[model samples]
Target: MEQLFSHGISDSISDSIPQQLYRPEQVRHMEAEAAARAGVDMWTLMQRAGAAGWTCLEQHASAEDQIAVLCGPGNNGGDGYIVAALAKEAGWQVRLFASAEPKTTDAQRALQQWLDADGEVEPLLDWPESEPDWIVDALLGTGIDSDLRGDIRECVEGVNEAKLSVLALDIPTGLHGDTGCALGDAIIADHTVTFVAVKRGLCTGAATAYRGKLWFADLGIQREFRLLTEPAAWHLQQDQLGQWLSPRPAHSHKGQHGHVLIVGGSQGMAGAVRLAGTAALRAGAGKVTVICEPGQEFLVGQQAELMVLGLEPEDPRVAELIEQATVFAMGPGLGRQDWGQRWWNWYLQGLERSDPQLELPTVLDADALNWLAESALELSSRNHWVLTPHPGEASRLLDCDGSDIEANRWLAAQTLQEQFGGVVVLKGAGSLICGSEGTAVSPFGCAAMASAGMGDVLTGMISALMGQAGALNITTEDSVRAAVMAHGLAGEAAAQALRPGTSRGLLASDLFPWIVHWINPNDS
Candidate 1:
């Protein structure tokens, strides 16, 4: 935490968000208690919040800029009242729109302060006569659990229609603070400056699209609050991942690092496994081997650096492969055909030696997920596996529709873990890694991953990280989270590099160089 009173805050507010994510309910439960403990009154806290928001706006707009301030009935509205007063005092052309009278004492006090300052409040019917340069959405805070109402919905629509640069306070109206799902119409702000704590919804689902650029202002009460509950998830950033990254020693050899075997590429669909193999190698796997179906060896082994072999029951090397590799990535081009199924069963059986506990780092993705669903293989406990599923594949695994998996991605990831007994990565806008460490979400998503082979690349990255985690001196949980951040960062990089003019269109292979670059940025 840095000093909130100094210009150091300017950089902090514009450039970064807090590391912890809190649910709205959680913040509500703690705010008053936290404020009281800090000897700060509700009015004082509201003043700080209002000041923080106003400071953010002032950076983008000057006294000459025309601005509109929207206020509701709650404390959020109080913040708006203060902002209006501040703007009015600063000689900016400002308009205040009130949906309802101040309902709380703090809000009433702030409204009276604005009135004393000779700030005029207008009805929330339409925009001001002069087109405002910006709009501040302080209408609804984080507590909204359901859909917007008649007047609120209309006001939200008006704000959206205004289309001017808008700064949303706390959260945008109509966006559920916990789930990030827009109940009806949500405010599409040009910037959102969240206060105190970040809500889980802002980092996941549909919320990511409307959230624009996010900034955080903690309101200078860092030590006053302690987390009473665990966060819904942790958000990982690209640059922060470097702390977990260490360069390979010059004396290090292939034997010291980990060997990763990619099992898949059944029959005609060899591209997927090939991508996964190359990704594993790029991601720092000491040695990568592709176990493809018969006659597909050459296709999967396109790179001389990777060893490719077809699975043969008669081949001794084929039987020993599962036991020999440090980690297994089972999926990608794997079909639900007999050949794929046989290999899946063979690997599972091969790993169950003297130890009763099923402990092997494996990532199940693509067609491997389909086979798991088809067979309905029930495991008694966790087998040290990671299941990477996009919404469609998640539905198949959960025996539900794609909509159900997406409806609540967090719940879906949790339910999958309970059923399948492993870490579950629900791949989407906010890719989640659910394990014993709880769920960590990477809210940063790249449009490039929308392409076909993106999942394959992710699978390879996760598997390779898991394979080499020992040499890296990182935990599986940390490795998984780091891999996710790296993958998304790579995708975002590829998207930017491939389409600097406009962001669209990407192949799976586009991320290969990025994977290598992120793992070893010194080379780049």
Candidate 2:
């Protein structure tokens, strides 16, 4: 049966937006320049921002509900003042709390306007008596260069204690727009209305926990801003998948799709190779072969579509098979035992000594990665290979602690790419695929893919795509990016369809049909 789950964007919304993502600093300057270019004053843009924020609040809050708008010392506080006045005019019980007076001209003007409109501004030193239905966090914007201390921290603590549904303006106060690190104390918002462009920080790590249900408000300047500054990064949108996917030719045959060879699965590990080989076939590999332990020949043969190659535990024929195949996937379920280690070493030596004339696209994962890391192989020079390492493996390869790798995932991926050269897929919640040019992150996959054997399936899928596309002359980097996106999308589909908390039951084998379904859903 074909898998029904795959991640994709609707046709209508796919082509409308560009994938350009910016750093917080770049976005702020871009917003200012864009506002100017639009013949709108900066204050006018701030007003629109506040209005947008108020509109968001109205959408989520009831008309009679009491709300507190927390303001800081800068323009972010100015936005709070505007929201407070808007809420007051709308007949809602609203109170404005600020740690310090507004300092910027637009902020001062906004404060005067709020006071003129009979809005009450109170110091946030003491907690409000009555708990409100909502809290507007405008304490800090993207300009937070220093840590949050003194009254701001106290204010944040009070808001948390109030147990109100906090809606942060622009960004959650205290999140470094560039690093996504919290500045001492930060507000945990239920919803955040970011302007212009989404900051990269919000999509990764602890930031994802704080910024809930993120909404992007262009504030009517995205286009102008995009023209002025190049995006440092971008989020993967669903619609762009088709562009990277290979279109089938009317007269195309199995041979045209290219062949994939999977080399792994030591004794008692046949399931990993089976998952990978079947995944390759499902991913549209014209031919799939699994070179596993001779003891597991029957297990590999159970999959009718996959060709089982019964090789001795440490056969040199494995290298020959690699030479003949269009792509190779190694390390899934590969044990570190004496037999497995000997096979691994032979495979490595074969790869190193292979005819320079025969360069096949390869994927190295699991034990393959561990062996290479332990051996200190110069991986960067092997441009034909792709390394898929989860955080632990990546830490081992980089000779760093796992926590260090998790602390700065983006930089870690970048460092891996710089050091290792080939496309590196740093798999985790927000899986990052980094190449020489730049990095792309897929925030789509869920905890469902955390189950056993998922990585093995990913290895095969990537290998297959590389093989299929490389035969057509697609760049290795582009192929890796597309494969990573597709793999995550399939995992997301499985997560959505299966029972909650049952992701552990989602075998890597289940993703193959979903991959096909996603690439061409309407097909028979």
Candidate 3:
């Protein structure tokens, strides 16, 4: 029987996971040369990739289990054929389906090898009539940039419709290796075994769902390939916490940890500001001040530690708080009403008038972002700020549709960072952070984070982290990436605590305790 649980890439392979990600074209251009330099031929590399994929399959399948391999016309198909030949030798029932005869010499040789192994091939006009334990997707490789068409599209659809466990070779068929977008449709694999370096496209965007439980095999070419190429982005991992955050000094006082000012919380939406303020405190900000709309002081300050000042947009106290704040996190519960607008203008004007050298780090989110999208005010690159925008808010900031942002999250993130300066945290599943240091992708976060006010908590976490960036002896980019990973991990932890192994009905505030736990990386 097939394994019921996901045993993600084994520990031995886990250590080999590549942090540096390359674009698909870069991987393609360098792989052949790298393989040759590593004293391996293309066929030899193909055999290594097939062997790694078979190992993953072995983890899922028992002896004599049925397996179906869908081979394409290219080298990706060659990988599928090699896996089929191995399964056949291992005493498994193998049914290989080909969309067309192998197109490349390497693939053709692989097809002949499968034939030599006594493996029969069938046309992939439809999914195999006999339901198999697993489907191997090798229909398309990383070169795909447009929508899938004709028989291949049908084949991809059939694989998805069949709803069998799928082990995708390289990338799930129909996913654009550079953009992570589905070409018309893509195979939704339960496990994806990718070769060489992890592709940048597989790290973000719509590819998140299609590429499940990603496993990588360097195929003995990573060192050579890495030497010849520059990473498109670095993958963010939980282990980065220790590298980015240090334990507070034992003699630390509230004044030393930095103050985080949360400027928002208009009217009935005090919960948003409250969440942000509380999260800031929980994340180890020494002091948290909320300059909320007048009459919201009680609601925003319900958390006793928060210094809540209900001040009008024009209040002098607001300026005082701004001057004292180590970092400003704007936008939570900042509605688009006149009150919100006044506060937005007030904050920007204060920044404009302040000495450029003393520019406070700011994080803009929610309605604050919406206001920025609508504003004609020019923001120079010198402004030290981080913009945290969900896809919808990002669409506004970029003047594109949300679908467009989701279609290419990496592009959207880079564009935002280039335009906005400081850093850009494009929040969502597999959030992308583009900062002055470069781009990074956070693989944390789960479905439970889809609820409301989640972004608010993230805003506070980012702000709190930024406040301590100096003491942590890290850059603003480092703080932002760490906060993103922590936020996602906290969300996952909260969901698990609510109901182990499930992600549902998790409130944003539920992340508070987990936030405390993750923020203190040295504690664990």
RMSD of each: 3.4, 6.8, 3.6
Tens digit of lDDT per residue, candidate 1, span 1-524?
A: 11122233322354476567878888888888777877777787787777778887888778888898989999999988887877777677888989999999999998998888778888876655647889998999987778888888887887788678888888888888877778777999877888777887888777887777788877655556644456667777666677677777879898776788888898888999999888888898888888889999888877778899887544678646766788878888988788888876765564545343225688889887887787565444454889999989999988999987766777888888888877899899989888888888896657657888888988888988898788889988888888888888888888888776335678889888888878774443
**RMSD in angstroms between candidate 2 and the native structure over all alpha carbons:** 6.8
What global local distance difference test value does model 3 have? Answer: 0.85
| TM-scores for every candidate against the unseen true structure | 0.92, 0.89, 0.95
Ranking by TM-score: 3, 1, 2
Q: Which ten residues in a row have the lowest lDDT in candidate 3?
A: 2-11
Clashing pairs in 2: 380-420
Clashing pairs in 3: none
Q: Which portions of model 3 show Cα errors greater than 4 Å? A: 1-16, 351-358
Error of 1 at 472 (Å): 1.4
In model 2, the worst 10-residue window by lDDT is 5-14
C-alpha lDDT values of all predictions: 0.80, 0.77, 0.85
lDDT of 2 by residue, 1-524 (tens): 11111112100111123466678888866778898887778787677777778877887898888798889889988888888887887788988888888899999988887888787778786446546788999989988878888888888877777667988998999887765667776788998887778787776666776787777777677778888988776677666566667467688888877788877778888888888888787777899988877678898779988888777645667656766788877888777876568767776666667655236777889998899898766433567778999999999999999988876777888888888777899888767788876877776666667788888888877887887784555777777777777888888787667775555667666677678876553345
Measured by TM-score, the strongest candidate is 3
Better of 1 and 3 by lDDT: 3
